[model samples]
Target: MPDLWQNICLHILLTCPIFVNVWSRHDHLYMGLDHRHHHHLHYEKDNDLSLWINEMQVKMFSGFSMKIFAIDNGKVSPHIKDPNFSMYLPTIPSEVSYVNFTWKSGAKKYDYHFDRLQSLDENILKPPSISIKTKGRVPRNPKEFSVFLPCSGNVSGVAMFSIGLLIQTRKGKPLPGTPLRLTLRKECAHRGVYDRASLTASQGPDPECDKKCANNGWCNHEKICQCPEGYMGQYCTQALCYPQCQNGGNCTAPAICSCPKGYQGRHCEG
Candidate 1:
């Protein structure tokens, strides 16, 4: 009773009824996996093994052939299931775009000085609407990125970050099931026992961009306008809206959806 093209791979499911997720201890980042629908072999399955990284490597488990261990601290125990996912998998995108995320806390301000943002091909990424902040900056080489809160005076704890992004096709159309949020938690140690990066500026704004920069964004060393949230382009002229305008919805500003008469909801999918 299988379809004409679904005969052989039917018996061979990606994961059996039960599965265990992989583990990580590398002090890099946190990522979340929004589940995708899988009706393989005509079975409604949500227990397939998820993917993760360890020691800066894309972990490859042939099947659900990994062991998952749990550690509880007070009321915090981590889980790896896509609990609230309800969408089909999208086709592969030709390009990936990461929105530069910056955070401001308390009275402390940070200026992340980097040469240029690199193009990363991460398997998972969050959307533009999600708040992805970071406490530190990898000024030289950025491998994995996440959101973090600024800690001061050797104050150490833990934080989670989701580097949201957009996936687009060759002709520049936003793919569906996108703006996927990836979260990773980092445990920080107290001072005198850890490595640290100078995230905050000891001085004032760069003279090159003090008065030249437009909008509320900062001017980096290269005199480029590091635009504020909900904006993009070299000069931050274009407002960004990921999963761009569906059902003829007009996106006048960042994440601001202008639905037509017959459609509603953000991105007008509802």
Candidate 2:
């Protein structure tokens, strides 16, 4: 009887490895749906996407060890060394609709540059061709690297940028880490256009007033509602200052009647 029990236990142990492997793959496939506990560095949630630089030995290519740093938000993270180095950018703020890569350095020697960077927007008909403008001055540090992205603009989407170096030897041989592919989280959004549903949406206006303003008007902290072109009123509900502009008066401003000849008072209602 003891031998029979031992044999059964051995059979269960042999099959457990296969079951665990299958379950792990299944869990990964559904990670997006249940990401509250997901801790993998490579697969973060969409709203909390992070950028990273994988490990690679720069000295292997140029025979000189090189350092790398990520500069963003007026702050620089810790520097990375050759081989087995990874730099993870901060979790993307919800207000940031998308990233922008406006410029790059034009230095010929020992300057930081991206070898592999591209937009993740699948809708983009053709990604913008990165123009290496020789007109710019040499970038002294990572701050003045000419990449002033992360702005609000008409275009919106995830701007993927792969970092690389330009090691120009006397022989002009090709360098390593030429283009590192970045698997960016795709998003269709323009720069500087914070999501309306986010807390940052009220950054420029009074929280309550912004939601109260109607008919293309924006509310300010002082409760002054700024109406759009061709509209006026405290809440932008009235078409004109006097709606009908009695006595031929015109609406020069919201709720402020502009009386015509011989007409006066708030609504030009002599």
Candidate 3:
């Protein structure tokens, strides 16, 4: 007979088939996160996920994305690649601790090899005086922003982003152990400014969509509703139709296609 501990582990593995957690728990290793990507969840049901010593590889089918932040101005940017891979936030996060990630996104592949976060250039960082002054004061509203990195994906090989930090001296000199460039990356969807998103999204309501989401949807940075499945329309008030209504038909309810006159099939094809 197996021991109680082994049985418990086996039970968990059997019950939680949708997700997995891989960890090392080392005290020294660190993985900094950008202000945009916080969730590790996905809609991929048929995919292979593996975690070896210090590397992670996921054969994803439905979604994948990543981002990098400018250390100096606190500006975040997305990593653009061919055939976009997007996903909504607000799901259970998978705990996959690895320094490197290989996203086998079918035809379009993305490989990320994240090194330890170290020093970056001083040109992009705020002055040391400002840093020293704002040491312990966490802002109610962080002044960081996210933008798309143009041409960042057009590299000879895998797009390289070195997300680094900088520690300056009193006289504005780059400290001893920092890099010459800054690379702070993230991967997320529905991260429109203001609305704040899932595990890794901002934490407050944006002013543009203030009092508009009505507890059913998330307002994106564009002041648009990023609704959940089954709901649609401005502020997510209308129901969603799967195969959308026909040429002139309207979606009257969830999965309900209101066909136009003379159209008589489920999706109005007949």
Candidate 4:
């Protein structure tokens, strides 16, 4: 009996390592033991017919990544990078819709399905703006994109203006440009014809204009408009008179002029 017991103990010890290894592998296969939690699925309920995703979460796996796609009425929306990304849905007759989430782990796949409530808001269904022309390659370096306005008439009473150009890639670290293009879009009117005005940016305006307007004036291609002290107007067309004169007195380009009891000059100094 002692010899038999000895033999049994030896057999058990020899198989212990093998059993442990098999159990570990099985756990990995069934419980994602070897895989990291790479992505998450989340949804929201709405009172209307359109289903919108209000939150999403995701993480990177050791050797894998994840993407999300939303399908509505049999049409697939664009793939979103994160589950938290919000989605706006179109109006539908039914208040509830179906959503499916497909998760891929290496060669393995998992799927989840849920019923999502849709709150169809007419305001949310309005199509995004497709009118802005965003063509041409975005500059690799600090390149200037400009719009030319032909006449001052086009700019007057403009109230607001904006233009957008698409950016393609970044070569080095990205620093936002002043007059950042993204924020400028909101200030622009949705639809309006603007008179052509040429826009260019450099260290300074044309060298000739710089030299011409050197003494506090603006040099145009054809002429220079010297702005007078305390006054700024088109071609010096108008004057800035402060402490405007009352009682029929004309204000000069800078100072207020009190005319004789009968006559009024721009500057009462007259």
The lDDT leader among the candidates is 2
**Tens-digit lDDT track for model 4 on 47-138?**
11111121111111011122221222111222221222222111111100111122211221212211121212212111112111233332
Error of 4 at 176 (Å): 4.5
C-alpha lDDT of all candidate models, in order: 0.32, 0.32, 0.29, 0.24
Error of 3 at 192 (Å): 25
Winning candidate number (TM-score)? 1
Q: Where does model 3 exceed 4 Å of error?
A: 1-210, 218-224
Task: Please give the range of 10 consecutive residues that has the lowest summed lDDT in model 3.
Answer: 55-64
Model 4 misplaced regions, further than 4 Å: 1-177, 180-218, 222-229, 233-238, 242-245, 255-270
lDDT of 3 by residue, 210-250 (tens): 46764377666555445443453345556544334567767
Query: Each model's TM-score, in the order given?
Result: 0.30, 0.25, 0.24, 0.20
Q: Write the per-residue lDDT of candidate 2 for residues 128-217, one digit (tens) a residue.
A: 222233222324233211111222234554444333434322355423332223333323244355232111122233547677678777
Give the CA lDDT, 0 to 100, for residue 34 in model 3: 34
- Best of the two (1, 2) by lDDT: 2
Error of 4 at 220 (Å): 3.1
By lDDT, the better pick of 2 and 3 is 2
* Number of the candidate with higher TM-score, 2 or 4: 2
Question: In model 1, which regions exceed 4 Å deviation?
Answer: 1-96, 101-214
Q: On a 0 to 1 TM-score scale, where does candidate 4 land against the true structure?
A: 0.20
